[model samples]
Target chain A: MIFDTTAIAAMDKLQRVQFATTLPGPKPLCLVGTRSLAGRSNLAPFSSVTHLGSNPILIGMVTRPDTVERHTLRNILETQSWTLNHVTEEFVAQAHQCSARYPEETSEFEATGLTEHHHPSITAPFVLESPIRFALKLEEIIDITSNNTKLVVGRVCFVEIPDESYSPDGTVDISRSLASTALDTYFSIQEVSRLPYAKPAPPTP
Target chain B: MIFDTTAIAAMDKLQRVQFATTLPGPKPLCLVGTRSLAGRSNLAPFSSVTHLGSNPILIGMVTRPDTVERHTLRNILETQSWTLNHVTEEFVAQAHQCSARYPEETSEFEATGLTEHHHPSITAPFVLESPIRFALKLEEIIDITSNNTKLVVGRVCFVEIPDESYSPDGTVDISRSLASTALDTYFSIQEVSRLPYAKPAPPTP
Candidate 1:
C-alpha cells in the first residue's frame, strides 16, 4: 500500500503513534529506572532508547510533551542519574505494566513485584531480574522544537551483564541476554548470523 | 562482567565503536537512499535510524562528523529528501556491501546490484526489492556540540509497503516483511506475541 503524509496525517492520534512506532521495526525495549529527590523510585518502559554515539558513549530516549506529569523524566532531572534494564520475555508483563500511570509516590518496581537493585555509585535503582543493565549519568537534554518532545541523552557510567553474554570482540550477544522489542506488541528476537565487516568485493576480472 | 566509562574509554577506536553499536541490541537496519543535485544516487546501510515522534511523523538518524565526505548525508542535504529501505535476509549481503566506502561519483545501487524505484512525488529513489520503504523530507539538523555528530531529523512524506504486511490498526507485521537487524551482523527476527495494552491490575475485592 502507498501512503502520503496527508493520508497518514488523517489517522487518529493513537493510530498514528502505533504506526510510527512500529515503522522503525523491532526496537530494543528497556525499563528506565530513576529516583526522585525525595528518594522515590520510578520505572517506565521505553522503546525509543537509541545509541547516539560511541566516543562519549551516549544513549538517548524520547519523552512526550509534559502535558501531564512524567514521573520518569522528573526523577531523572532530580537525580541526574538513571538505569536502563533490558526487558526480556520472562518479565515483559511486569515491564509493560510500568507504563501504567501510577501516582508519583507509587514505585512501579514495588507495584509490579520487580526487584530493585541498587549500585553504590549511582542513586537510581536497576531491575534485579534484568540480565543486562546500564548505570548512566545525565549528559544533555535536547528539546526537539518541531514537536514538544524531549530527547534525553545519558553517558554510560557503568554496565553489568552476565559474562557469557559478552562476546570476545567487545560486542554483547543480546540474544543470550533475552532482550525483547516493543510497539503495541512484543516480539522475541532470534540471532540469525553474525557476518564479518562489509568490504568491497574482490576486483572482478 | 562489569565495565565503567573509564574502562570503555581505554579500548581502541574500532573496539569502542563495535561495542557501543551492539550495546543497543539488534538495530533496525536499512539502506538509506538519496540523490544529489546532479541526480546521482547513493545507498548506505545505517543502523542509527530511529523514530523520533509521531505527531509530526519525525525520524532521526545520526551521521558521524563529516571529517571525511559522507555521501549519504551529502546527498540528503543536497536534495532535501531521502528514502529508508529496510534490509532483509534475502538481500543482506548486497545491503551490507552498500557500507563500503565507495567514491562520491559511484552509485551504490549499481555497485551493489540493488534496483532503485522512484515514486512520482519524491525525487529520492527507494530500493525496489525492499518490502518496506519510507520517503522523507529533511526537517531539521541538530549538531551534537560535544562530539560534532549531526542528528538529522526528517518528516515522513510518503511510504510504500507490501499490502499484506500492514495490519488493520496501523501496525506493520515486519516478520512478514523480512526486516533484519544490523551491528556487524544480520539477524532474522521472530515475532513472539503481541500483547494487549498494559493497564493497572485490578485491586483485590
Candidate 2:
C-alpha cells in the first residue's frame, strides 16, 4: 500500500513509529558501552551505528531525545570514550535487555549477566561475548535541525575481530552477526554471493 | 587480534578501508534514485540509509567526497526530492551495477536495465522491482567537520510496502530483503524472532 505524508501523519503514534522505523530495512545491531566520569559503566543497544569514514576510521550513531539512551549519551559526552560490540545471535537477548530503563547506578552488563571486559588503554568497557569490538573516542556531536536528535561521531582507537571472520583481503564477514529491524524484530543473515567490483557494461552490439 | 590506532594507521589504504568498513557489520542496502532538474535520472546503491527520526519520518545517508555518489547528492540538492528502494536479492546485481560511474547524460535505470516507475505526485522515479520504496524530500544537510563527508537528511514523503511483508503492528518484515556489507558482500536475511518491549527486571524475591 502507498502511504503519503497525510496518510502517515494519520497513523497512531505506535504505528507511525513502527512504519517509519521499519522502512529503512535491516540495520547493524551493536551494544554501545560507555563510562561516566564518576566511574559508572553504561550499556545500551543501538542499531544506528554507521560507518562514516575510513582514513581515520570514523563511526556515527543517532541518539533520540529520549531518556533510555540518555545515560549512554551523557557518559560518552563526559568521558569522551565508548565501545561498540556487535550483537551475535547467542547473546542478542541479553543485548536487547540492555535497552531497559535501568537506574544510573545499574550496569546493563551486570543486570543482563553479560561479562564486561576492559582494555588497559581504553576507559570504556566492552562486551566479552561480542565477536567484534571497537574502542572509540568521541570526535563530534552534530545536531539534526529538522529533528531534536543528535548524531554522535566517534574516532576508532582500537579494533578486535574474530580471527575466523577476518578475511585475507582485510574484509570481515559478518553474516553470522544478528541484524535487527524497526524496534523489535531480529534477523540472521546468510552470505549470498560476493561480486567483483562493478564496471560500466561493455558497449552493446 | 587487537589493532590499536597506530597499527590501524600503518595498514595500507585498501586494507584500512576494507577493515574499517566491514567492522560495522551488515547494513541495509538501497538503490537511491533522484532526478536532476535538467531531467536526467540517476540511481546508485548505498548502504548508509539510516532512520533518523519518526515524528516527521526523516532518513539520513552519508555521501562520500568521491564522484560516484555525487550525481545522486547533487540531484537531491537541486530538486529537493529522491526515492529509496530496498535492494532485493533478485535485482541486487542490477542495483549494484548502478554504482558504476555513468556519465551525467546516462540514467543508471536504462544502463542497468531496471524498470523505473513514477508516481503522479512525486517526480522521482521508483524501482519497479523493489518491494519497498520511499519517496523523500530533502530536509537538511549536516557536514562532518572531522571529515569532509556530507550527511544528506530527507523527510519521508510517501512509502510503498508489500502487503504480504507488512504486519498488523505496523512493522514490516524485511527478512526477505537482501542486505549488503562492506562494498561487495550481499546476504539474505531470515527472521529469527520478534522481541517484546524491554522492561526493567523486577526486584529479586
Per-residue lDDT tens digits for candidate 1, residues A121-169, read 8899999998889988888888777777777888888989899887666
Regions more than 4 Å wrong, model 2: none
Error of 1 at B40 (Å): 0.8
- lDDT, candidates in the order shown: 0.79, 0.89
The candidate scoring highest on TM-score is 2
Which residue pairs clash within candidate 2?
none
Top-lDDT structure, candidate number: 2
Best by DockQ, which number?
A: 2
**Model 1's lDDT to the true fold?**
0.79
lDDT by residue for model 2 over A1-205, one digit each (tens)? 8889998888888998898889888899999999999988889999988999989999999998685899999998899999999988898889889989999889998899999999999999999999899999999999988988999999999999877877767788686788888878888999888888898888989
For each model in turn, which proportion of the native inter-chain contacts is also found? 0.68, 0.80
Model 2: which docking level applies? high
